[model samples]
Target: MLDLRSFLEVCKKEGELLELRDVDWDVELGTLTELLAEKGGPALLFDKFKDYPEGFRVATDMYTTVKRFALAIDMPPDTNGLEIIKKWRAVDFEPVKPVEVATGPVMENVDEGEDVNLLKFPVPRFHERDGGRYMGTGVAIIIRDPDEGWVNVGVQRVMLHDERTLGLYISPGKHNAIIREKYWSKGESCPVVMDFGPTPLLFLSAASHVAWGISEMEWAGYLAKEPLEVIAGKVTGLPVPANSEIAIEGEYLPPDVESRKEGPLGEWTGYYGGGERSEPVVHVKAVYHRDNPILAGTPPIKPPNYAFAVQVRTTPLLWNELEKAGIRGIRGVWEHGAGGGRMLTIISLKQEYGGHAMRAALTAAGSHAAGYMSKLVIVVDEDIDPTNTNEVLWAVVSRANFEDSVSIIKGCWGTRLDPALPPEKREKGDLTHSVMIINACRPFYWKDRFPPVNRASEELRKKVIEKWVNEIPLLRG
Candidate 1:
């Protein structure tokens, strides 16, 4: 099993890691996530922050690079994310139970009560306008099923409040939210473990909540192709990765009893929505970490950022799942850049009949974990690549006859994070929007063949490259 320590060793060997020393937390760390985004830079390691000692560090941008993405998926150097997704589709996963470890690096230090100071770590203020230092962007939160005796893990953001408390914003769609809701419903606090510096594989597995009754640690083993090693927590019964650099054990209290403002910073949607409603308060029970721990994070905002990479790798999985729904001839799918990867989806398919394309579009709109928020669904012919914006535009202009080709529906759908939606809809209540699907395929019911295209042949391209590559040295990487 690849533990957290071994994962860090691998990242170091790949020449993709950077260590930042004595960085200030108030604005320094937030600036770092942005600078790296601007440059498409490597992952960072902040060794020291404002009040923290030199030992604690924060790691960001680990999943920002393609190489890191390749590593997380266990693909070879030459393989891209699409190739990895194809492999994932072919494999039949077998869950491997975690191996219990008696001792590990995560136990090197244990702090409780007044000594538990979250500010002592290199927790970053991710954006200049953020509410406070956010310590939980890249962390995996662990929760247990009430009746099944199974542990579930998922990546969620947490806002650090003070030494003894934090603001937990568990999305209503995630397993952590359900677990916390169960606790709050009964007027009891839910025991939870937040692991900040676990293996990248843990975060990858945790990002997707497993089906009901499925253990996420076992799913981690399925992805790693080996068993994972976990250590039981000191206060919470949750099992954390044995080699994790930092683990915080806590409980989520009722929102009415404990709540506070959590954000006004850049969200994954790229806009700073005023801020999320006050979340429930978490009472920290214990903090455990290895010596010289590294805290990893990604300040979410806009396209080409952390959420984009996640959507690029994961949203495509929905395509495979849609095909299993008996939909056929799926060509390509793209979640547009605007929605922070959650709000918009565009698909190209070879439609078998009038409603096939619309069926595919709706499936992509309402699939699992998408939070029911698809702003627009555009469907085009198989000849077009959904990833190419120009092709999508061309299909829309050339084939969509507007009145005949566009299908618009209006009613209560999932429309979260859309500022344009009415206040009642943006709140817990559902919002209504005119959902349109532009059938950009040729009128095959009327015409037999599409207009021909003019392009270079594969043989001609190969001959041209063979002749000019050496002559034009700039053409070679």
Candidate 2:
């Protein structure tokens, strides 16, 4: 969709939208959103905040379900997670540049210089222990590479420090962080344009693990098969989504020049792993928004309730990479949401030879998409369903020999959000951690002699269900 309004209309038609009135922005708003998400509730649009003016709204849980996520990407509502991944993997890699416009609805109400008051919008304190009200959870932070001149759109946490200042936290090795350092090395500030409420397509692209030099805006356009409309920022000269709800043009000051204490907020890993620390601050030069702007909120909730409902974006990348690496007989790939969608991965493949399962596990554990912050990578036979945790666990306990099936690799790529990292290592600037690879497939030497499953065969089960449907109502389910 070109704008969030259109996406919300689709969600409403699909019975996925829920509007709430008179909600408090302090902690109640976030608490209720989390509770609903835990129970797989509908997306929320909060209006008439306890203190803020009416018409200024907040939208949360936009991608809390597979159907909603599929609609955002212009896929059929009934599309499943694996199917979406396969479709994404088949798309071309060429970047589709965004089309620039002179002006758009985002500039309908512009607050420049002294009139930049971020608090005018109801920024919610998402979690009880969050440092302050955040405005950049469901955001796209746009910056251009000083040397390459290619634009980059990324999703990073932005906490409100004041009306005209914001605290930005970009993980080390991220494209934005690398670009910001390039500016700092030249003794200059990094110009930035933050879209506080991007369309669902734009947000999905921004939050994805896109290649380093490619722009997320272009990625979104490529996926949508149409160019997104953008306008040059008045202060930063960066491309801002023309139809975005709320946007700000600012510059990230050098750490020596200015910094702010940030974090202790809940992260996607379900932990406050990145404790409070001094980070770069954004000096907002201008604020642009449409009348009655709606700020999107995507606070990180505990495991099983993630910012994105399913691992629909990255799982396909890993699967494609495995095939490209010459590994064969791949049946499926799944990343568990309980591990923040990156920490735990499960791959199911047919065993063609001895050590085949371990090879697949190692390749996946070290793959570009699964390497970062990965704690465990498990490999199962083609018979197991990787998406189902119970089946994967059963295979692990029944087939895997702990001594021979597990391998640990140390000092792999990791992030500060890893809760298992030792405090001393973190203090020493060592963000690396270990990864465990487990091959849960039966030993290939005696594959033919492996015990048969206790359940009925697929053919027999389907025939019985079809024959008993009229007599047994539960069989339909």
lDDT (tens digit, per residue) of candidate 1 on 1-477: 555555556777887677777777777677876778668777776775656677777777777766776666566656675665565443465778988888778889999877898877767787877888788888888888775678888887888898878877765556677777777788888888999887877787787534556677887787777777888877887887877889889887788788887765567766665365676788998999998888878678566565556665455566766776778998877766665666666778887876787788776656663424566778888989887878898888988778888776666254344556667656656645556667777765754666665767869977888889998977565
- Give the RMSD in angstroms, all C-alphas superposed, for model 2: 2.1
TM-score of 2: 0.94
Error of 1 at 296 (Å): 1.2
Question: Residue-wise lDDT of candidate 2 within 181-229, one digit each (tens)?
Answer: 9999988999999999898888888887777788889888888888999
Segments in model 1 whose C-alpha atoms lie over 4 Å from true places: 3-5, 88-91, 209-212, 274-276, 369-371, 409-416, 427-435, 447-477
Best by TM-score: 2
- What lDDT is reached at residue 263 by model 2? 83
* Cα error of candidate 2 at position 301, Å: 0.6
Which ranges of candidate 2 are over 4 A from the true structure?
307-310, 454-477
